[model samples]
Target: MSVTRHKVWDPLVRIFHWSLVIAFAANALFTDPESNLHEWIGYVVVALIAIRILWGVVGTRYARFTSFPPSASGALGQLSDIATGRKRAHLGHTPLGAMMIYNLLLTMLAIGVSGYMMTTNAYWGVDWVEELHEIFVTWAEISIVLHIGAVIWESLRTGVNLPRAMVSGVKTVPEGIKIEP
Candidate 1:
């Protein structure tokens, strides 16, 4: 069967997505925590998240928050589909994926805020603030791992190239795949 391709992620969204990946990885894995580079990368992450939030409000169809609003029922439905071995390709983010997006956004924001606070006189040398930042970073790391696994699982299940879609802004759905509207 033939494949039908549709543009889903926009250019800004794709850029933000990959930029966050690099920024987060650099700070979490490579950068020296006490150095200026780490602080700058943290700020970059904050800026990227801010841009993404704005784009979610005023960007293209797939980038808008309205396109994939957080819903308990929607998440449950997706879980059910998985349990029942049903394949459904979502035009934008699946409900579970939407939840992950919110999770990462909030988690990243928390990390950024805490990291900034550590640099302030009021919060500097505060053990709790530093610990809180570490906690958020750990959570974000766990969430990132889950996010990657879910993307791979969903891509194979629905026969969609999810990573490629994010990079190219288009998803090529197989003809017989059930696509969520």
Candidate 2:
């Protein structure tokens, strides 16, 4: 039986994801302690993050948060599957993956908001806000590393390259799975 391919993530979402990845990675590595480049990168990240949140609510079917939010129970259920190595192939994000998506978004938002606050007069030179901003960035980095690792592992396990799927917006489903366009 031939597996059918369906459009999952939209082009805009894919572009946003990759672009944010590049920008965030660059911001993390290339920004100097006293340079303005980091601030500019933070601004771009903030805009991208805000746009993505809006898109989550009004984006394409597979891209919408409603389509794949993993409830607490759902996430726990996947833990068993992961333990048993009996993971089900999903046309979109799996339960754990969905949670990671939410985490990444929220963490990025926190980092961006805190970083922005440090530039404002009310918060400028406030040592505590700077410390909090640094903490947020650290979490964002850790979350991103975990997210990439999961993507790689899932791709290898399922024989489906997730990055490729995001780029193409088309994913090949298993023969027994039915994707409704």
* Count of backbone collisions in candidate 2: 0
**Candidate 2 residue pairs that clash:** none
Best by TM-score: 1
Query: How high is the lDDT of residue 38 in model 2?
Result: 86
Off by over 4 Å in 2: 174-181
Roughly what TM-score does model 1 have, to 2 decimal places? Answer: 0.99
Which tens-of-lDDT digit does each residue in 38-83 have in candidate 1? 9999999999999999999999999999999999999999999999
lDDT (CA) per prediction: 0.96, 0.82
TM-scores, in order shown?
0.99, 0.91
Query: Model 1, stretches more than 4 Å misplaced?
Result: none
User: lDDT for model 1, on a 0 to 1 scale?
Assistant: 0.96
